[model samples]
Target: MRLDGTVALVTGASSGIGAAASVSLARQGAAVAVVARRRERLDELAARIRGDGGDVLVIEADITQEAQAVEAVERTASELGRIDTLVNNAGVMLLGPAAGAPMTEWQRMVEINVLGLLYCAHAALPYLLKAAGAGPRHVADMVNVSSVAGRVPRSGSSVYNLTKHGVGAFSEALRQEVGQKHVRISLVEPGAVETELAGHNRPEVLETIRARFGGIERMQPEDIADAITYIVTRPRHVAVNELLIRPTEQE
Candidate 1:
């Protein structure tokens, strides 16, 4: 379960789950590249990791942009030498009834949640394969942060659900294609974690959803981070493919 000398790149790393995961990976001795659109937040996260004597790089870029995504991976590899793990954690959730939902929000969701992950994966695949073959760990890994909405489409979250479902499907196909190469791909599906994901919802919808979760405790970002750490820290021969985490009282 040791990740010493490994280098991991985590997108959406400004705060919440991505931030927590970045710190967790650093704590495990992996040099981490923290990426997000918020340069300030990324800088702060990098500073924190460095304060703890961990190796980190702050890369501020909008991953939805293909060029930026490619550059991010390139920069990480250039500074760190290789990428042993990649966490596609950048995503947007625009939840609402599909019939009358704003088209712009849907477009944004698709672009960030689906296409953004694709761009990062495409750009990082070659490096991942190289690291898998030559790095100390000898096994590279990819973790896609999906949602339980991907598995069960709720009534009011058509677009958000679609994007997550797409992530699951993509992750599955990629896992099959890359398994023989010893590059492990895994999906982490979280149910109702307390994060900024719901911040993108309309005011009315956000109020309603908050009221609903107010009664039942939601999972924290650290919980999901812990799950991610567990998956990536496993032995070279062990691949934990899919992990579904929800608060005990979520249902």
Candidate 2:
């Protein structure tokens, strides 16, 4: 479970699951590159990791842009050496009725949740593959943070469902393509985590969500981070392809 000489890049790392994953990986001896659009938040996160004697790099980039994503990956590889792990965790969930839903919501979800993940993964694949072939670990990991909605489509979550489902499909296909190269690709689907993920929803949608999940307990960001760490820490020959973690009371 040690990653003493490894470097891990985590997107959407300002807060929630991504932030927790970055810290957890660093604590396990990996140098972490935290990517997010909010520079202030990233700086704070970097300070926290550094306070704990962990190496960290704060990368402020809008991953929805292909060129920025490429630059971020390249910069990380140049500054930190090589990327042994990549966590494509930047995503947005704007849940509401499909009918009469604002086009902005759908477009934003697709751009950030789907396209952003694709951009980062595409940019980091070469470095990850090259690292996987080297010694010390001989395996690299790419973990995509999806959601339970990906596996189960429900009303008021049509577009959100579509994006997460796409993540699942892409992860599986890429896993097959890179498995023989020892580049492990995994998908982690979480159900009802307590994070800022719901802050982007409209007032009406927030009310609906509150009504639906009022009494159900939600998992913390660290819980999902734990799942991600487990997947990436497995032995080189062992690959945990998919993990679905739900709160005890979620179902």
Candidate 3:
């Protein structure tokens, strides 16, 4: 579980699971490169990590753009030495009825949730491979943060579900492609977590969610972060392919 002399890059690091995972990795002795679109939040996170005597590099970029995603990976590897771990956690969830859903929302979801993850994975793959072939850890890790929606299809979440399901499919294919190389590709599907992920929902959608889960206890970002840490911290021979974490009450 010790990651000393290794570097980890985390996307969507401004808040929620990304932020928590960054802190967790840093605590485990990995030099963390936190990527996000929000500079203020990234700086704040960096300050906290630095205060704890952990190394961190803040790279502010919107991974939805291919060039920006590439740059984020390049900068991390160039400046922080090499990327031993990558956590693709940037995503957005805009829930609503599919009949007359706003095209803008659907496009945004695909761009951020799907395209962004792809861009980051594409840009970081080479570095991950190189790190796995050499270096202190000898094995690299890529953890894609997906959702239970990927596995469960429900009404009013057609496009969001599509993006998540796509993530699962992509992760499995990549795992097969890169497994023998010692570059692990893992997928984490979270049922429901307390984060700002639902903040983009429309009023009606928000109300619908509130009514449904008003009494159900939601998991926290650290819960998912812990799962991610566990996957990445295993021995080189250990590969945790897929982890589905749902709250006990989240049937």
Give each model's whole-structure lDDT.
0.93, 0.95, 0.95
Q: How close is candidate 3 to the true structure, as a TM-score?
A: 0.99
Candidate 3 per-residue lDDT, tens place, 156-177, comes to 8999999999999999999999
Instruction: Supply the global lDDT for candidate 1.
Output: 0.93
Clashing pairs in 2: none
Task: Report residue 33 deviation for candidate 3 (angstroms).
Answer: 0.7
Q: How many backbone clashes does candidate 2 have?
A: 0
lDDT per residue, candidate 1, 154-248, as tens digits?
A: 89888888999999999999999998888999999999888888887899888878887889989999999999999999988999999999899
Estimated TM-score for each candidate = 0.98, 0.99, 0.99
- For model 2, what is the error of residue 62's alpha carbon versus the real structure, in angstroms, after optimal superposition? 0.6
Residue 45, model 3: Cα distance from true site in angstroms: 0.5
* Residue-pair clashes per candidate: 0, 0, 0
For model 1, what is the error of residue 155's alpha carbon versus the real structure, in angstroms, after optimal superposition?
0.4
lDDT of 3 at 9: 98
